[model samples]
Each structure stands twice: as C-alpha cells, then as structure tokens.
Target: MAGRRALKAVLIDLSGTLHIEDTAVPGAQDALNRLRQASVAVKFVTNTTKESKQNLLERLQHLNFNLHEKEIFTSLSAARSLLEQKQLRPLLLVEDSALEDFNGIDTLEPNSVVVGLAPDHFNYQTLNRAFRLILDGAPLIAIHKARYYKQKDGLALGPGPFVTGLEYATDCKATVVGKPEKSFFTQALTDVGCSPSEAVMIGDDARDDVGGAQNAGMLGILVKTGKYREGDENKINPPPHLTCDSFPDAVEHILQNLL
Candidate 1:
C-alpha cells in the first residue's frame, strides 16, 4: 500500500465479517481477542438497521464476543445525527426493533422519509405513504443502499431496491448515510481519534465495506465470508488492500504485517 501508516485503529463490519446472524464466524472471537491483546483500538462499524445498538450488543455477547456498546458505531446513529442536525422529523420506514435508536426524535407529521431494511414496512400501503410524502417535498434519507445482505439461509434483499424505487418515483436522490459513504467513514474514524491512513476496515461486502473504506483513505480488507461471492474484489476499482479467507485471517495479517 502506498500510504501505509502505523495502524492505530481497526474498524470492523459486524454482521458478515464477524458473524452471520446468530452464528459466529469460525475463529472470529479468538481472532478479536488477539487484536485486543495487541493493544489495537478496535471499533465495530455496521450498517445494520434491523435492530438497535443495545440489541446488537446483546446479540454479540450471546455469540461470545466481548465489546462495549459505545465501541459500536452504526449507520442508524449517523442517520439519527443527520435528522437531528437538520431538525427534520422523519417518517421512519425501518424495523420496529431499530426504532429505539431514534426514540427521542420527533416523528409527528414527518417532514422527511428515512428508510432502512424493513420487510414489514415495505408493503404497498406503507411505501405509498412514503411515496406521497416524498412527492410532496419530503426528503428521502437511506441509511444504506446495500443490494443484499447475508442471512443464515443464503442472501436476502436489502433496502437498496426500495430506496431506488422511491428515487425513481419521486425523481429525487436520497441522501445516503451508511457504508461506501465518505461521511460515515469520517464519523467512525473520528470516534477512534484515528486518521483514515491509520485505520483498516475489514468486511465481507467488497463494494460497501471494502471499496467504501478505500475511497475514504483507509486500507480495506475484504473477507471471503458473509455475502461475499467469488470475483467480488474485481468488481471494485482499486481492489481491497488484502482479501483474506475470513475475519481471523484478516487479523493474522494485521498482526503479522500491518503492526
């Protein structure tokens, strides 16, 4: 890598890289422990909007991963920050479980539309409601436009298609506040007090996790797990700094070379 700097922090993708659903990736827990022993600042950055941060932490703990809630930065947090910054009450089309993160936000007479992966809310009536709202000048905010994500049973559709449908209907581009977005990476890096050059991002999605981090000036490592398919690395221009077999493999690389 041309701009290699001393590794100060490691930003990891939670769902796919470390675990998929309730099942932990092989050796991932031990691998994280290795990183912990090495004294590297580790932060979990996720675009998961299915559940609140508290719930997510609980799931991680259930999977035997030890981490603090504050160490986890999420796109939901970013979307909420944006909503607060603009003072726009939003009609949230996210999962009910994810609503806890936006608890304090005003949702009355929503002046904007915030969307994530909400299968229950993606029905015709609800989508039409959001459609009418956007057609009436309400801004659309997408937490992330991932095409699909890994589930215990193969892959499932993400909110990208829904977001695109809204965009097409309203002819208004939605403001994205998740992975592959430079602002999200900037915010995550800021929390760890690390510059982009001093951080590495490990994830399974080549486009969002790897490509996005690389675009934001961090070394991106694509893991061959989660929603990863063969030849995914080639899909991105300037492929990942390293494409490893799994989370543990990525950690070994960090300990052996990057450190």
Candidate 2:
C-alpha cells in the first residue's frame, strides 16, 4: 500500500499494543521512543474504566513507558465530556474518589444516575434503586462496553453486561462514552487538533480500536497481542488496513507506509 505521508499522529491501545498484564511488550518501548525521536505525536486510547487518567499514566511510567497525562484518553474522560455536553446532572453510581476532581456537569439529582465498577458495592438494594432511577428516565452512561476483560486468573465480567442489564430493565439505551463510539474518537482528534486522516488507530481488539477508527475515517492497524488470537481475522467485521505480529512491527509499518 502507498504510504499515508500526511499522517501526523498515532493512537495506540494500552493493554495489547504497549503491554500486557503490567509487563511491557518486547520492542514496544523502543517503538515509542522512535516515534518521539521523530517528533511524531502519539496518543494512548483505552477502554479501561477502572483507573483514573493520572493513575493510568503513573502505571505506564512505572512500567518504563514514556507518556504524559495529556497523551492519554480514557473512557471515563469521554463519559465526563458526554455528560457535560448533554447538560445532564446525574446521581452518581460510581466510586466516591473517582469524581473528586471531576469538573463535568453535576450528577446529583434524584433523576440522574451513573454506574461504575462497584463489585463490592453491588447488591440487590443498590441495583433496585438504580433501576428505579433509570425507569424515571435518567440518562444511562457507561465508561466501557466490554463484556469481559482478561485477567491473570481468567475473564472477569466487565461493565458492559451490567450496563446491558440496566438497559434491559429500564428500556433505555445506555450511551457508551468509549471506543467504537464516534464521539470519543472525535473528542480525541479535536484535543490533538488532528484530522482523522492524520492519525492511525493501533490495537488488539478488532471491534473497538480498529473497527472504531476505520468507521471514523482513520487508518486502523491490528496487533497480535492482548485479547487477539491466531485466526481471529475471520471475526473482524471491517478488516484492518494492516496487521502486524506485534507493536514493534506495527510501528515499523507505520514509519514505512505512513511517515
């Protein structure tokens, strides 16, 4: 394929693209260093909702990955932006500390509701109350839409299934403020002041990063890392523009075909 010489930015997925389970992928760090040396701007886009933006950055730094807070985009950030844009004040169903510095619209009304990963807090009473709020027409917002996430032990139920239950009980569709949604992608591009054509989305999840970016008019590159297995290509609805063995190879392809 001809190089997209106009490309100016690269959006990478954190888990599969850079590392897996707190361990940096081989050649991932070097690839990022190369991009920085070349002055090619980069952004880390993720669907993880369990950690705050600062926390995520700190973790990455601890892993020896050079990144700044501003270079990261989380689904939580997108959720906050959507709430602000819709002018919806919600009754938060999230972690108390998560909203400490949240500057978005107030989410404290009786009719407002927001759900977070509260495994320890989830119970019959709380869920019942949340359902009532939803029945009352409060807008539902979720940070992630994943059915489950990979863990050292095994797969764990993600926020998606819980969000789905709420949607079914109240018949209200939850507005997902994460990947595969155009709003989040648009927000990231706007934040960097870059066009979709100038950016490439690289990730292991075919549905979220690759398909999402392609849907928004950007190039998508799939990496064979986290959550992706051999022969998973048949499952991709909209095939990626390029597929690489790992993040390092993906970066090399970008340098050759895009830069």
The most accurate candidate by lDDT is: 1
Candidate 2, lDDT over the whole model: 0.79
lDDT of 1 by residue, 100-163 (tens): 9999999999999999999999999999999999999999999999999977778889999999
Assess candidate 1 and give its TM-score to the true structure: 0.98
lDDT of each: 0.95, 0.79
Instruction: For each candidate, give its TM-score against the true structure.
Output: 0.98, 0.90
Query: Model 1: residues >4 Å from true position, as ranges?
Result: 1-3
Quote model 2's TM-score. Answer: 0.90
**Runs in model 2 lying further than 4 Å from the true structure:** 1-5, 95-97, 101-107
lDDT string for model 2 (156-257, tens) is 777778889989998889888888787778788877888887789999888788888888878899888888768665567678988888998998888876
**Which pairs, if any, clash in model 1?**
none
